[model samples]
Target chain A: MAARKSSQSHSGGLELLFSNQRKHKVSIPSTSDATTGQPSNVAFLIKWLCDNLMRDPRKEMFVLDDTARPGILVLINDADWELEGEEKYELQAGDEVVFVSTLHGG
Target chain B: MNGFSGTDHQVHNLKQQIAATETQLHSLKLQLQQAEQQAEAARHLSEAYQGGFPAEWMDETLVALQQDVTRDIAQKVRQEGGFEGAPSVRDAAQPRRWPLEKHEYKRYGRQLIMPEVGLHGQLRLKNARVLIVGVGGLGCPAAAYLAGAGVGTLGLMDGDTVEESNLHRQIAHSTARVDMNKTQSAMEYLQSLNPHVNYNRHEFHLTPQKAIQIFEQYDLVLDCTDHPTSRYLISDACILTGKTLVSASALKTEGQLIVLNNPPRPPGDALGGPCYRCIFPKPPPAESVLSCGEGGILGPVVGVMGVLQALEAIKVLTARAQRPANGGDWSTNGATSEAAPKATLLMFSTYNTPQFRSVRLRSRRADCAACSAQSTISRQSLTSGSLDYVAFCGATAPINLLPPASRVTATDFSRLPRDGSNVLIDVRDETQYAICALRGSVNVPWTGSADTWLERALASGLSFGGGRQHFVMCRFGNDSQLAAKAVMERTQTPVAVKDVKGGFKSWRDEVDPSWPDY
Candidate 1:
């Protein structure tokens, strides 16, 4: 697995761990300064997480509805998407979204 | 006879030697034992303090160093033609002082233009130096609104980096900002939001020296930081500087706002006027309360409070007269002076039943270390020797006597058995599951409330009542844990339930992060 970044104490408790299973970086179109390659649009982010980043729903890592977006954890900085909004949340260019599997421990 | 005499002498000599040898041996053993103990203690201390930098490591490092770079920026900007942004000064007062932009007049803008605010109020805001200590959930919205409302110059102070987990409610940042410094990231966003407003970024912790120095420069201070240490520091700094403070918080659905000013003023006809300490003199135990980060909050919930803060800041700048006091306690409600004073306190509840209240805050505590210090240097000195205020405020201590579990990373996580032992059961999504997971146990992907999950688990015959225990887990171990705890409270079940320390990630490293470090 690729090394993931750990959340610091003072920054609240947000740990960003991405799936090391994929070797390639998925490109999400930048809506904010298009020339800057930064993704500022929330809709684009949802599409990116659902289509490119999310794995097959049938897989352990991918556990969202087959017709819907894959089960992904959207952390705005370190907060969860469920508490805020799902993919509908507006994203600035420099913010981060960590993709994790929803299969959870059994 | 001669033989008898020789025997007695020999016996006496042998006894003396034996006694001397015994004393020597005892002293040597004691010294050896003490040396061993010291070595053991040193080794343990090293283990306890050693580690990869925490997510807030940068923040901590900034605190450890000296030199208030943030203060320097504020002072420099204060002296050298204001922040690089929109024209700040307005007309009427200092002519040719600077080109003053006349704020476009609007109706019910009474709050914006009351006599106090007139042209002078706008200038105070324009010339004001406000330092926001954190840019997380509370800090993010507070700072953003402050900038948008045109609080002339804003100082963003936070030593933390953005993380993916914070995306939930920290709207200030986006996914791209992960691993970036929060203060710098926020500053960039604030500047973009309002090009005309000048913003200063303090990519360091709020040391007393820095806090006092910066506090001295600013007209008011806003406490949006999360931790107790920072809260106390902000409070102390404000009192010492005689500046107003707009402190706000939102944990889960409940939110609070307190406005404190130096030289505490009585609640004339106004709503509530109380210092931050009046409501909470000292920081509460960390475990006694849960933060929005740990407790979970709705997005708009915080947004509401953030906007209110802007209103309060504007109110202070605009109010013309004292509020006419009604026959009510100002502490529970906000000040209602028809003539709002230049300094006041305002607090509210955004979620559930929304209530607007203000109180008259008590003046500086004669013994307040932050304020009321005879010597400025003495006040500055207190911050360094001050016990880690966060910990001293009881934020660091674990609530449970069972022992506060230490946090370990996925790299260091070691899984244990799941045979219904002393562990807590966490059943949340896999993504959350990956970052923090308990080893060798039942993993049920349970989302939603406890009532929903419990009813389903029971109807499904999951046998949660079995010898095996369950401790529900979620990110920050908030909702699920609360659900589980609530279930236990209502049912009084005999199940050994305990929320994993720091939830899953905490458990993974401290208990067993290896279960699956995603």
Candidate 2:
């Protein structure tokens, strides 16, 4: 039921997708608006994640401040965020944003 | 009538002078034609012999003619200009020869046959001096490939010693070299592979004071280091020293490669390629970072990135040394002047469909603190140790959430009852537990939920009677603390939960000498 609600919201609001490899999965809100009632962008979406999904937002043990984190690659509609103006790239209806981490040992 | 007669006499004298000049011009033309024939014959002879004939026995006249033709052809080519589009005639005329021994040719014959990397490119490779920062998973394969390609000099820098755990992905180090200095171990392996390569070993760790000085000695720098501090340090050092950096990083099943701070073609007319800071101005919070030991990585994923790093390094080194011969499409662009080298970032994911993607990176920022003309991170600044890379990248604070009472040292934990009355939970991953584990210990991998496992264990009557304590452990005691906290939070009944201090590493060092360390 939660998965269906999140999928239905994908057509209405910004479709946020995590790379399947991520450790945790959270249900996206069905409404088209951000939790703060502001237009959803990358920074606001990150805040939404921390406030709603994370176990402890104060400790931020699960996720760091995504805006400043260097290792996480953000893709906007399959293009690099760097090409899409990074965090400044505004989210549109049905816009898909994907986040993947690049910080692991080689 | 007297003036007309004087004019006629003057005209007759002028005609006689012109006749004498014409005769001289005709004779000079004949001589020029003979010289042209001689030069043409010499060129034909040279082309036919193809340098097989000994120069000492050749006619003096023929040698002079051959030299003249070469000079004239080179001059004409120069006059035409913009041969950046064409296969350089000068390059083709004087075929580059590898200055090394015959054995080197046999050693790198496979690489030499590639049209992009012919004799000229091989010679360039032989002249390259590359510095590989870390002799870990990424550095091992990169250094191996560079050595096999006959890179003239390799500088390996690492302070850590090889461990049995490193043998899985750090392929350059073998089981025999366990406990040996990583730099020394890697050098021994590389030297065995190619004795001709000059190995420069830096046994000390990379500090800003030493990074700039060491980077200045090498033509290219490879950021194979895992930590963010080392990544920023290598990028800054390469920028300050005017050396190209081929940086590669792999984590889990993903890897990334980027060539940073590549010097502009004309050198300093415009800015060089983007430095690491231009893209990643700051590092992620230290709490979010995880090493391969903690996160785990596929060996081949890192190997793929390492191999790509070597490939990019070869391209940069060869392109810098000589223009690509044989009209090779190695040219990144057609424009000659004001063409800043393009920076590209490559991302590879081995999961799912196994995808490799490349994105064009932005050019060097005019205000970039490291690589720009008026930047702040100068060689002097680095040498003075004013730029603290570790502090800049935020030091990883010691993970000490639980109080001292909730944690027990390895020495104390070793003395605990090994009988079935007490339960010891090893929180390391299955792979690590398979390697080596203590007796009478149950394996519970440190995942998101410790409560689920604890509930199952309690229901199964593993923790049966009174006075039984649950002790959690991990590789280095970090994850064990988290596990202990999780269990403490979830248990409703009166139960004692404590983590082993310093994990199994400390156990191996302080408690038992026989336990094999990863």
Those runs of model 1 whose alpha carbons end farther than 4 Å from true positions after fitting are: A1-106, B1-117, B262-274, B319-351, B354-380, B383-387, B395-503, B506-518
Report the C-alpha lDDT of model 1 over B16-92, residue by residue, as the tens digit.
89976765565455445444544454455345446632323223223222123333333334333334554324311
Interface RMSD of 1: 17.2
Q: Taking candidate 1, what TM-score does its chain B reach relative to the real chain B?
A: 0.55
All-Cα superposition RMSD per candidate: 28.9, 13.4
Top TM-score prediction, candidate number? 2
TM-score of chain A of each: 0.42, 0.53
TM-score of 2: 0.70
Q: TM-score of the candidate numbered 1? A: 0.48
- In order, the TM-score of chain B in each prediction is 0.55, 0.70
